[model samples]
Target: MLKMKPVTRQKVNIVIDILMFVVMAALAVIGFLIRYTLISGEARWEKFGSNIEMTLFGLDRHQWGFIHLVLGVMLAVLLVLHIVFHWKQIICLFRRLTPLRPQRYALVSAITVVSLLILISPFFLKVELGESIRGQGERGGRNVSRTSGAYLPSESEDRTPLSSEVLNELPQTQAIHQNQNRRHGEARMLEIKGYHTIGTLAKNYNVSAAKLKNTLNIPSDVSSNERLGRIRRIYGFSMREVEECILALQHSTGDQTQHNNSQ
Candidate 1:
């Protein structure tokens, strides 16, 4: 029988810590990217060459809510592990603080307390948070509408017409054209109202935010209203009635567009 070398518990613990740290770091980065992309309305590529759509479980806004819930649980678990591994250091730092250094202690305590409040506020307040130190709802240009689709404009006056020349200039225009060819060479224009954020759009469409973006060939990072404009330009559903017609066709026959013999 071959003798097996015993692995020290400390070494195992170290390995676990290293692995956990790597995972935690990755999760943090992913979470940050997701929030940033959603808030800023954009996308990023991961090391594995996957597109993280600022979405949950790779789904759209509604789907992302479920995904966010699951990810949040995983984040809590990782956070616990991080605390467990660093408890000794944390305790030591606390112990080192003394009344003699009242200012130092007060400063550290204030910072810690503020940080804690910032971290947990989103959960309690029912608002999304971001990595930026600025408080939630303070970010400029954030307009959330409950009734509009994900890409609808926040204000009626802010709405802009889709421009084909602008579309032709995009870096992904060639790829879009190729994809467009598969459906039809023609593009439709549409203007939609209701739902100002992707999350709202996902809920209204009964699809994931990611799917809507993918289906419309809109980048995850684009602003919500801009994305809607792109879809409108691509599909020629410039009006609500036309959009309704397209949707009706999709529901009635699973056909996005088909020629009518009468026409």
Candidate 2:
């Protein structure tokens, strides 16, 4: 039988160790990038004005996820090879752990089987569908709309610049009255979502934070920086209502501008 020299075996072990370390570090960084940088669809819309496909180095989140999976598989294979290389050491360690031969063998076998089963469980696991929050599934993570690469709502309740009835419910914004000469006709509909804050809406949509609060009938206690989603859950408001108020404010501003110009 052809045998590997001890020096060659040592070199191979060192290479495997280096590869494993590199793979682990890569996995950690990619995992953080996917979780924090790419973020969820709703969060992307809130931050980037739309559900723009988040990418790193020209690869989208799903593509990075695929690479992550490949790296995970490679790590698994490396681990198996590492174990094979050190099998004798493992056996010796097990012997030292327990004196009774039968008990030691049985315990080792049981632990090995259980560890493997835990690793394999994800494949066979039945994923239960939990009660989804409203608008949670509108844009699935990393699977956004292909058309225009922007989040397009169906003709549904969640649509931004919402219907007339909701808009009618909101009061006229103070900013519109305060800046009568300003051409709000140029004011565009903001891609508002529950993830946005009152401050964010005010800044991005060119509205008044105080007036927005009034339009939404938001409580005084809620901070401007607080997310609309959390505020809605507690205060019985909807993202639709927020969007309606924003559109109404824009319209009111424009109408006031037109009236002033005519005068």
Candidate 3:
């Protein structure tokens, strides 16, 4: 066996910088989609999608808080890295600034200072711009509250509530019910016979080993290598009961597979 050489700090820094760029870009795109499509009602999805929309576009008071926080931290890290990378250049620039025209230097400094303040303010400021936007929308004609994203309404507008019966009736409850049904079906379908390992059980059920353990709440006293007796003790399931449950699951799975095949 050969030992691999450790990765260099420069490589790690580059990777981190690249990742930062990717995350920032993704955040920007998500923000834009939430703002333009979701807010404007040009495109629609489920309620959670709409909630996500609210979160991304800063419609919800609590939304964008984490985003802002994460971005602020990333910006700080980036700033530090940038300064570290270009320390000599930055020092030279500052030194040369005195020789430049006073008005030009003042303007540059002002812009730089303002930009830095904005980058840092979100970390400290508790101001909720989302609430302000929502309030404005409520006062205005556009019914922004119904959707997930904040809507900008005109000043000279009626505060009449728009009909949100459609949006309010998002099928989240139905989707949740279906998901629960599916999980129950899956749990029922999972079977353990004579001697089976958790890993094998998980593989048969097309689920992760961790998920199987979590679903069953397997006791810590039951070692991974323990026999069926431990399972019976932990779950209070007799051999007959276990067999019946397995049969029920097999039937259900067969029916589902048939239905899917037919479809």
Question: Candidate 3, after superposition: displacement of residue 150 in Å?
Answer: 31
Q: For candidate 2, give the lDDT.
A: 0.65
- State, as a TM-score between 0 and 1, how close model 3 is to the true structure: 0.31
lDDT of 1 by residue, 152-229 (tens): 233433455223344334433343333221222112222234223445555555445554554455567755544344
Q: What TM-score goes with each of the models?
A: 0.32, 0.56, 0.31
List candidate 3 segments past 4 Å from native: 40-65, 92-263
lDDT of 2 at 89: 94
- Candidate rank order under TM-score: 2, 1, 3
Q: Report the error of model 3 at residue 40, Å.
A: 7.1
Q: Cα RMSD for candidate 1?
A: 16.4
Residue 261 of candidate 2: its Cα lDDT?
85
Best by TM-score: 2
Each prediction's RMSD to truth: 16.4, 10.8, 22.0
The local lDDT score (0 to 100) that residue 140 gets in candidate 3 is 15
